[model samples]
Target chain A: EADIYQTPRYLVIGTGKKITLECSQTMGHDKMYWYQQDPGMELHLIHYSYGVNSTEKGDLSSESTVSRIRTEHFPLTLESARPSHTSQYLCASSDLTLGAGYNEQFFGPGTRLTVL
Target chain B: AQSVSQHNHHVILSEAASLELGCNYSYGGTVNLFWYVQYPGQHLQLLLKYFSGDPLVKGIKGFEAEFIKSKFSFNLRKPSVQWSDTAEYFCAVAPSSGTYKYIFGTGTRLKVLA
Candidate 1:
């Protein structure tokens, strides 16, 4: 079955630790996004990729960086994580066609990170 | 920039009670509207969407929403909600530019008591 997956669903690490959150999709989507969400808060887009090697920063500035080396994988990495970096990170993929009006995003289960 | 607003932060209701969640957006030109629900420990999934045509759109789990263009609102409603309806609901709006960027509202946590 085709689905989006994220590794390390829950993680707890001390401040200044380096971490990488993995996201992959089998749905063969052209568009991928990464969002950061705090408990009981709205999600904020942190990064997005239109296709392989095409990365763009989103509305919310994030300390982490993302690279789309392959079409199926978009990983976010934090060189030195801080306590404020603790949040649920969600990854989503969408198949978009020009003039298609709208497209629904398929979301992953999200990775919850706690930086102590 | 486009933005979305959700009226309620938290709501508590008994099973079988009527439900309505308010959503509003600020955007110019045509836009696509959507409602997404996230159950406990589950991924966020689409409940309904409004692109064009009929203003009233029906969705899974007996959920529906009406797109009132004049009021710039797309509100979700259910005639009678069940205990399983408890979840976090988010309203999103995207400009019809064939892009996947969406502006999401602060979610509303709905608790339906059985």
Candidate 2:
């Protein structure tokens, strides 16, 4: 079946460690997004991309950065992980044809990050 | 910029009970609305969506929602819920353009007891 995939499902690293979370989709969607959440809490938009070579910051201010080098892959990087950065990062994408106020999103299983 | 808000941080219901979750959004122009459910250890999946034409929409697992434009609300409902329905439900909104980036509510954890 087609789906979005997130790598490093679980991660535990020192406060200063650099980390990258990978996301990919097989459905060929042109739009992708990254969200951060504290388990059971609300999700906050951190970054998003329209297509390859296009990216924008979300409403939430996050220290991490994301890149869309390819249409199917949108990776998020934390230059210096902090204890405050401990959270679940979710990856999602949507095809625009689902359009006109019809916002259905396809999400990955999500990557859980822990900063010690 | 757009935003989504979901009330009911946590909900507990017995099997066969009815379910409803509140959702609201802030956007001045046209937009899309959706409901997504995340089962334990699973990815978030779309339950249903309301784009246009109809205000009420039915989704998988017998869940449905109605978009009240005047109220600025899109609420998810299920006539009868099952224990297997235990999961987190999120309401989302997105502007008509851009990357179609979505703004999600915090989420409501629904626990359906057997």
Give me the TM-scores of chain B across the candidates: 0.97, 0.96
> Model 1, which residues run further than 4 Å from truth?
none
TM-score of each: 0.97, 0.94
**What is the Å distance of residue A100 in model 2 from its true position?**
5.3
Docking class of 1: medium
Clash pairs, model 2 backbone: A42-B106, A101-B32
Find the candidate with the highest lDDT and give its number.
Answer: 1
Give candidate 2's fnat, 2 decimals: 0.87
TM-score of chain A of 1: 0.96
Q: Write the per-residue lDDT of candidate 2 for residues A11-45, one digit (tens) a residue.
A: 99998999999999999988899999886667888
Cα-based lDDT for every prediction: 0.93, 0.88
Candidate whose TM-score is highest: 1
lDDT of 1 by residue, A1-116 (tens): 99999998999999999999999999999899999999777889999999999999999999999999999999999999999999999999987666666788889999999999
- What TM value does chain B of candidate 1 have? 0.97
Q: Indicate the residue-level lDDT of A53 in model 1.
A: 94
